[model samples]
Target chain A: MIRDTIRPGTILRVLVLVALIAFLVAPERFAGLLAPLTTNNAPPIYNQGSLVDLTLSHLFTVAISTLAAAVVAVSLAVFVTRPAGREFLALSRAVVNIGQTFPPVAVLALSVPAMGFGEAPTRMALFLYGLLPIFENTLVGLSTLPPAVVEAASAMGMTGRQRLLKVELPLAMPLILEGLRLSAVIGLATATIGSTVAAKGLGEVIIAGLLSNNLAFIVQGGVITGVLAVLISDGFQAVARQAAKKSGTRPQTET
Target chain B: MTMLADAGPDEPAASWRIDRLGVVIALLLVVALALPFATFRATRIASGTGLLLHEALPAPAAAAAAAALVAALAGAVTLRRPALRLAAGVLALVALALGVGAAAAFLTPADNPYARIAPGSGFWVGVFAAAMLVTDAMVRLRLGPAGRLIALAMTAALIAALLASGAWSRLSLLAEYRSRADVFWREANTHVILAAGSLAAAVAVGLPLGILAHRVRRLRDPMINVLNVIQTIPSMALFGILIAPLGWIAANVPGAHALGIRGIGMAPAFLALFLYSLLPMVANTIVGLNGVSRAVVDAARGMGLTGLQRLFQVEMPLALPVILTGIRIVLVQNIGLATVAALIGGGGFGVFLFQGLGQTATDLILLGALPPVALAFAAAVVLDAVIEISGRGKP
Candidate 1:
């Protein structure tokens, strides 16, 4: 279609593409995405290798943590969406809202006492915050299932669990995926807080730049973080769109 | 009016019930009159506030009179059928007002045993709480969208009032009261003003970009996808990244420093803040635009409106509520994240927020934190009220 080639959001696409291209070639303009491992005494927060590994592991943590949250959120949503479970739905929603409202930095500080200042606590915090979108969307998706299809399945002798797994879950998958996409995006952003609590991530590079007052290092960190955020969020959105197409549903990611 | 018009056109009913409201009003007035008499050291209060308002009277007598006034106002709390939850609210205001008029330190000597609840402090709380409740209620009852716009006007008024009335001089608890008021004001108000500015700048830049992309289908997804990605970057780390580059620009650029560009001040902190608000604004704008009906657009085009005209006349209006919602979200969020900008010395209300955390001075932090939280919530509610008033354009 004519709309496909010159979409309304064209400039945004070009700009983002350029940013991505420039970022991928970053190693060519520089040695790598990180500064050297050094021991200059100041606010020297993290070394170089940790920075590299931190970025990689942080992504993994986000992916896995979000995946875990997705499972819990979706199932909770399904269970709570049942006719007998309306109260649970309201309760879970309130819980999710409070979880998101409880600031991440506050969580980081508090988690230090129990989780001992590292990736574990940061992951826990991200997982907790990610629930808002996923849980909210799952309930929405499950509730929106077409009645005719559900009745037809039930009329054919599908058990309660059978109908949920076969018909309801499939019907709700697209909306559920949208929730996951939002969670994935939020989870990736929040991963930066890990640095303050001694959790490894791209934030280490940022913290490093701050301590040394090095402009290049700061750009390196910001560019990399931006690039990562863009890539992962886009990937999740793509999957969500694909799921929406398969299910033949409206595409919506905004909550 | 349809149910949506909100207020019951019952002003005559409201006025007629003033007699019913009289118990609260009278009680509050009496309490204000009597407080100086009951204050810990009546001798000092007689000289303190009685020197002015009731110069003819003694402190104990004044304090007793004020207490009596307050007890009467307290009766308003006894009313039922909270009626849009305003009855409980009005009673709260009257009690607070009378309490302040009676107990404020302005009317009692510093050493007065009962000076703990100074008349000055009480009056501020009483008046503010009363004003807030009544103002909010009136807005809902009568003004609608106009109410929200006026709320912002009111917040500005409150700020001015705080400054003019020298209320800033009295905004401290007993434990923290002796500290510098100017310092606290600077540390608090500056952050809020800066946060608002940053969010505004973000919306300014983001809206046009979003509109452009929304009109360009090919550009929309990729651009939004990138914005989506950029948004996922942690705010704290993003701040860390801007310091060096922005600091360099500040040091090197001519007159940049003169333009309020400190290494870690408004510019870089704003750059970080701006970037953070981008995704939501851009995405929401695009989504809102996309959500607009194609048939209506075609009709606008058919009705002889040019593309630009349609954008302004049709699309923009329809998309506005959604775009504003996005703006509201970003604005509220940036206010919170702006607190972190203090880490880089960007000098916003966050200065106190972060310090409160670092020093564990909940009092100091509360001084910083409560205002912005209150401001953001009020803004959100007012905006919702505005959307409610905007009426069927699609929020």
Candidate 2:
């Protein structure tokens, strides 16, 4: 269905998200993934081993937050995207959009009071704000099931849940997975916002270095986080593609 | 038509429960309004004044509670008829006016009722009154799903109004909320313009990038990836990064003074907010473009359409939903990120937030945060309406 999404699109996407996540989970992996002979000025500090510990925490937080986000998001998607639920669909999505659109930094900043300081509030903010993508995608994927396939499933005596689990979900898996992939990457990137709240993450390094004018620290931090996001995003995308391929489903949008 | 016969079974109990819940919520609100009126005590109203922050009830806050009771009952009773709803809403507002006049009837400085009614518990009671009144009117207007939704929506609005009005009193820093109705309108207007500008910039930047990536396969990944990175950087850090370079440019650039560059005005703030917004705009564009079906493209081409012609006519038109999707995303994000711009000499709504943070003033932060939020909701509704009107890519 992707009309103009550019070519080698997958690889750039892989690099984009993989690079970010690698910086977090396996900085060593990220360093090795780089093409080695880079001419870019900012490459060296990214390859260095200075930010391993900090990157780990950021990765861990994002991973947890993404998982937490998935439950709420998928449920919300189910609620809002149903035909009967359409009235509120736009509104719910809009709410999610607002949540995400607000700068993660703003969420953390606004949250300090009442919610008080620490990782708990940051996590709460991240979870609340980061639910849009997956929610939107999951709803789209589930709702747009081809009539023929759904009819066939019902004709074959499949139960409603079975049809959903077997036919619809599989068919929609690719796009849904893509949404998750992007959401995961976005979540990881925004996790840096948590640093402002004094939550432990690579953001702390980035924020501290930027404020303190410690270019080396900034370089190290940015590179590591960027690599981490890329790697994880790539992995999700690969899984998405595999899922799509397994389903042998035609893309929606036949003219 | 055949698929309709094979439609999946729904959870009867679940659907029933939701309907019940909606009605239940509406009833609870109605009950709350009426019940409180019975238990309500008619204590004497209070009067006092100092800073906006220092206003308190001259008499016990019980009187304010009594007013809340009256406002709620009045709201509940007046909302039965469409015409009456508006009239009652207006009448209660007038009663509120009289209450204020009575409270502050004497000398106006240390004895102003404006502070007492608008501050602390008075402000809270006022919120309850406003909520009851507005919710009552909304129910009569026949807005769907509002019974349950309005409760939450009204609460949020009330909280935000409380904070905004606090700032408007101008007794604080970061953002001085001017309490006069005219000043309030001005601040609200500023927020609207800020939101509009943000959406405009995002749409302008995103649409082209989406088209470019769609046309050039190799460009897609890199474009989307760049957006992803843009999204990841926290606004605070982004601002921190932007300040040094931007401030340097503003300070050194020749003829900058003629450009309305005040060393730290809107320039750096816009840049920071703009950078952070790249993710949704770019990502939505990529997603939408990718989603255009091959069959449609092939059909256009087979019909003898040139590459450019098909790209513009078939492809972009078909891709409008996805494009709108991006717009929606960018618009929402812009509203929120606009606030963060206030932190570093950037102007928008964040001044209230940071000021509140610094001074422990919830009201100030709320003021800065509210208008953008309200605007986002308004924009979302308008965009959806446009999307519906166009019938873009919908089955």
Candidate 3:
């Protein structure tokens, strides 16, 4: 069963990696292939910046923001779920849930006024945008641990801290990672919008394409971003499945 | 069971002992004191000077605002009753709103059309904290759907009254709204139509497709997988990707232009939103249907009901709440995404947002941004109430 799932995922990962590499390393090579899509003598490939640099920066922005969001959200989740902090649970949950309704683009726009343009606002936006899913998932993961298992931990004389670190966390790792997976996917997609505010990313490529009416650049940027999101999402799923299997828990079905 | 017994005796006392409202009030007080109360700009779109509360408002008003905030904080810490805490929160919110408006009015020169005043970080943070306090109190009070709706209505009316009073007329956001009120309403209309129209389309199509997926086991995975792939694509990239093919169609297809099907306009934007709406709609429908109790379905079968009748009478009614949950999700999601539609000339609140971005006009951006947030929030609450009411009606 493990092999059945892992094999297809591995093949897909390989395929996507190759395509991403081709786009970054030799984007011009695809220019001839894309020429049919362009009109008005528009350049078939985006030339203002190397695709490699754009992709790296996009990944970097997503990485930094998602990391920051994970740290804060996971910690906040832990804080509220603890007995001492249980009183604040409803308030925290409301904040997390309601925060999700704000469109990420709007958040990005709002940040620009406060932080000024460039990567700062984008990162802030991504960080804020990434919080809800991770926080909610962490809360779910921690709270939903089977009561029997918890009792067993207590019965075995495990200290509260030890039980959390050793048993509960391990059991909840899959769902927690699922949350991280969601945050990362969302960050990756949202980071593209950061380009509009002069943040460097794959969105730069797309926006460039749109401004010039270059079909090729649009396709290149769109394909690369879509593939990147899919691959990362798949990778997260594979890891989550592995974690769930190790912990003897069922992997959550995708919504 | 042992664990429950272990915690049961002291849990209620422990939970009620701590005043969580105190934390929110403390945060509010800190925010009120620490950040700028308002920003005074020389002209619209120019960087503003942040003014502390003392500097922004007249001495008496500033002192009064400070006194109100301190009182709220004290009340939060000392008050044992939820009602008192709730009142304190409302008082703090009102004081902050009026204080910010007063600051705007005070800071703006009487004859300067170019000068603008905006609420600074302090005001925004205080508002958030006050709102949190109110929400926390409401949750603790265990207000039902009707109570919550009443609260929402009261809040809306308060805001309307504030706006009508012209207390915030000097605020840059209001100035931006005043100048482009016509454009604002038009874009607001566009935004709602884009969100609601797409949702309607998704429901019309997704319901049958969802039913088909439920009936045909083989088609389910592929259908979901395709939608997932579509969902994975970034909205900006997806919007850009649609332009090429759509533009080609518009140019070549004879009636396409006449039908308002073009590369960069509502067509692509509407289509993209429609596409994004489908997954939640279909997935929820399937999940809701699958959630129907097997025994109940069997009982319906035993009653000589056909498969179609069983589905309609037994399955769908049971699934309505879950399906409505899906609709809620799509509606909120579409409302947010519709803002991005402005990028392609789809003309929604995003028009103001992107325009504000281009001009570095903060108030213009807020004008574009706030409505959709309000709309999505309102939709979520209303639909949640609907879902709850429907769920309660279930047998």
Candidate 4:
């Protein structure tokens, strides 16, 4: 029965690995077929930078914003859960809700002028855009602990600080990790759009393709970005799974 | 807090005291009363336009002070439950109306017809603070979904009445829209078409895939991963990628080329948006279907019902709410993402948005950005109501 089951995930992984290796070892040999994807009067294939460099920049942009968002969101979540900070919970929630509601494009457009056209504005937009999911997830993680568990911790003479660090946070690790994963995955896609504001990433190739009507550049850019996003998401999902296993808590998938 | 606990029996002071949210209202009011309400600009663009000496017209200081006083009075209301709720709601609404009035009054003083008065930092902050205060009071009132809707409707009606009164005829955003009314309406129609078309396409593709994934255990993981991967591709990159294959097909295939599937335009934009919408729809459908109780399924089968009959009669009704929730997310998401289509010459409000960015015109950007936001928000609210109603109908 087990052998009868064709594991599509394994096959997909192997296929993707082979494709990545082929692309890296011989870019022309692998992605060369895409070169013909051009219309009449289209510009030559984008040669300003290699795929490897663009991938690095794309990952860099997404990573920085995701990290920044995670730090800020997790810290804010922790703060609002504290006794003195509890009153500000609704206010914080409202702020994050507004952040979620504002589209990334609007944020990018609004930010570009003040911050200038580069990774700075892109990072800012990504950070703001990614805050809500992480914050809300962390809030849910921290707040949903069983009352009896908390009472027991208090009864056992644990200090407030110790209880938070040793008990509550560890129990909430899987959920918090899930939030970070969500943020990182979202950041991956949003970072590409940053190219419109002159931020260096895979999006520049795509934008270049659009402007020049060159299918090759678009295909190449899209493939690299799509692959990177998949890999990044898989990596995060694996980490979340490990975290869940360690903490003995099933990770909730629904937002 | 301690004082309330320690109050003398003779003094019913606790019943007549202002709370923390009220204090925020008072503080914001004080800030507004002290600062300038708005700034007046000379032209739309041009850092150093001809003979330009930009004027920073002062606010209608008296009207602002009056608004602040009203806000403070609202915050101080401690008349106990029902009375307190009513008084605070009225006061917050009054404060909001006055804030708008103050802004209007600020614009009226601009004698130059060409002058544009932008809401100043003080006015913006005051309005936000007042809104937060009102939201807090609404929370205190413990309003249900229906009550909240009524409150929102009332606020909208009030704003419309204000607009009818010509209270904001000189507002910068409205003026920008007025100048491009024809183009704006056209773009708005295009945006709606793009959003709705993509949503319909997504539902068509996603619904069956979701069911297939749910039924086949092995297909579920890989299928979901593929959808998730698709979602992660930046919208711009996705649109870019589609242009190549789509453009190629349009060129080579006689049928496709005739159907308006060009390299850049609505085709690629719609395709990209359709891809983006699939994930949530598929995920939600699977979740909804899977959530149906095993016992209910057993009961349905025990009744000698066929697979299709059981699914239609029992499972679908139960899953409808979850499915609708998915549709809601997709609809709202598509609305926002459709704005990106403008980058590829796909007509939408994004024309104004990108143009505004290119020109560094904040008001113009707002003109494009606000409608999509309002659309997404309205879509979400309506969908939530649908989900709620569907949920309530289930046995």
lDDT of 4 by residue, B1-395 (tens): 01001111121235445555456556776675455555556765533111101122233544454654564445444433533545554565455454544454555444666666555555555666666655544544555456656766786687788767766667777778889999999999999999999999888899889888889989988788777878877777788778777877898898997888998899999999998899988998899999999999999999999999998898878989989988988887888888889988898988888788767787787788878877776676556556766788465
Candidate 3 lDDT over A26-118, as tens digits, reads 888878888988888888888998889999999999999999999999888888888877767776777766788788889999999889999
DockQ of candidate 3, scored on C-alphas against the true complex (2 decimals): 0.51
Better DockQ candidate (1, 4): 4
Q: After superposition, how far is residue A222 of candidate 1 from its true place, in Å?
A: 3.5
| All-Cα superposition RMSD per candidate | 11.0, 9.7, 3.3, 6.0
Q: Supply the global lDDT for candidate 2.
A: 0.55
Runs with alpha carbons beyond 4 Å of true place in candidate 1: A1-49, A56-68, A88-103, A106-124, A198-201, A245-255, B1-184, B291-310, B356-373, B393-395
Off by over 4 Å in 4: A1-31, A39-44, A49-57, A94-98, A112-117, B1-36, B47-61, B64-66, B69-114, B302-305, B393-395
lDDT of 3 by residue, B1-395 (tens): 00001111123544345476576567677877789999999989778899999999999999999888888878777675668878988999999999999998888897888999999998888888777777666666666667667777898899999999998888899999999999889989999999999999999999999999988989998899888878878888788788878999999999999998998889889999999899998998899998998999999999999999999999999999989999998998899999988877899999999889888889998998899998888787778777777888676
lDDT string, candidate 2, A30-91, tens digits: 44333232234444233323465666677777778878888888777766555566434433
- What's the C-alpha lDDT at position B277 in model 2? 63
Q: Which stretches of candidate 3 lie over 4 Å from their true place?
A: A1-13, B1-11, B14-21
Model 1 CA lDDT for position A191: 75
Question: Which of the two candidates, 1 or 3, achieves a greater lDDT against the reference?
Answer: 3
- Per-residue error for B267 in candidate 4, Å, reads 1.4
- Give candidate 2 misplaced runs (Cα > 4 Å): A1-50, A76-110, A210-223, A250-255, B1-18, B23-269, B272-328, B343-345, B358-360, B386-395
Residue B304, model 2: Cα distance from true site in angstroms: 16
As a whole number from 0 to 100, the lDDT of residue B156 in candidate 1 is 69
Give the Cα lDDT of each candidate: 0.60, 0.55, 0.85, 0.72
State the TM-score, rounded to 2 decimals, of chain A in model 1.
0.80
